[model samples]
Target: MRLLLVEDNLSLADSLTRALNQCGFAVDCMHNGADADQVLRTEDYALVILDLGLPKLDGLEVLRRLRQRRNKVPVLILTAHGSIDERVKGLDLGADDYLTKPCDLTELEARARALIRRSHGFDSAELTFGPLSYDSVSRVFSLPAGPLSLTPREHAVLEVLLMRGGKAVSKDALSEKIFGLDESSSPDAIEIYVHRLRKKLDGSGVAIVTLRGLGYLLETRDAAA
Candidate 1:
């Protein structure tokens, strides 16, 4: 999935970005809230990690404008302050969750997964289609035969499709979700990942199908047929 991280602490941002990237999320970082607000206005992200002590614009204002525009992207707020009132205010302003600074990277990752799953309407960590199953916690894809082996890009592509369940995902949308701003992205690149995933999933009873003008759809073999 794609995520936007807004934080002024360069060191902390770098660590968090690296950790989240390792977790299979394509992440974009902004150092201040103004830039963050501008980015959010145009791009779609699965989640946002907002640090409240941002410069140019504070995180609360960014969140307020985001909600004012009716955007429902999940947000996890981070701040140096541990005041309950601040936490309550952020929650009230549409922040999906909160973490005090000096937070655990492990905890941040877990919370990120939860927010993403909740946004996608998944009530649990596991998502299944036909014989294929995925564990959000473990970030593993499996079949009855064995675990599915995938490169990082391939894993990301499959995750997006499975999250959509049966919905169509355009190549552009897929690219957005899986490629960070710094990474090179193209429709052909997405196709390559899908092709690779298809090879890996052969005879798994689930399939990724191309629908002309409708983008890509993941479904059981029966549904595709």
Candidate 2:
């Protein structure tokens, strides 16, 4: 497996790199979020171990830009900030997992493996529907050329639809899947995410067709063509 370790601490980076390498991973170590963001655009890695504090940029920004570009590589955040708000913010921005600083190497390795396994899809990695392709490992939905940029909720909505193939998905289902029990969301809010997604995929050779009583279904121009 290939992994990127982005930690400003050279010593910690080296240690993590060595440990991951020993566990049969090809690890690329870098310092600073600027380099991490730059390298991430051109390279594909199974996972990214990102530290929040960096000299050039914050790891959260690196992650935000990553998701904005529609890259779905799983990210495991490493930080000294273990506050509830910080962790929630990272997750909200698309981080797959988080590890507070001064953690155990064994736990980190285990989390890495789990994220990779889920992403690469031990069950199903890549799913295609007409002109769109969803990579389970990277969690990126792509057109022919590259990944599809989407907001966090939009990504979640599309993922549920794609996973269902041609089956109808209700607004209630979308709302439930994207919203947490502790969070507030209305059924109308689900419509907004779907509308935004529909606009983004407008000319992409596929369509999110409304099914009236059923909900919405992703369809190729010619369901029978």
lDDT at position 124, candidate 2? 49
lDDT of 1 by residue, 1-225 (tens): 899999999998999899988888889999999999999999989999999999999999999999999999999998897899999989999999999999998999999999999898998999888889999999999988889988988998999999898899999999988888888778779999989898887777888999998899887875224
What TM-scores do the predictions have?
0.96, 0.55
Best by TM-score: 1
TM-score of 2: 0.55
lDDT of each: 0.91, 0.81
Global Cα lDDT for candidate 1: 0.91
Residue-level lDDT tens digits of model 2 in 1-225: 457889998888888878976665657777999998998987767788999988799999999999999999899999998999999999999999999989998889878877876774544456788889977546678987678999777887887677567789888766654553335679889888888998888777888889999998888884233
Stretch of 10 with least lDDT, candidate 2: 175-184
Clashing pairs in 2: 72-138, 119-137, 120-137
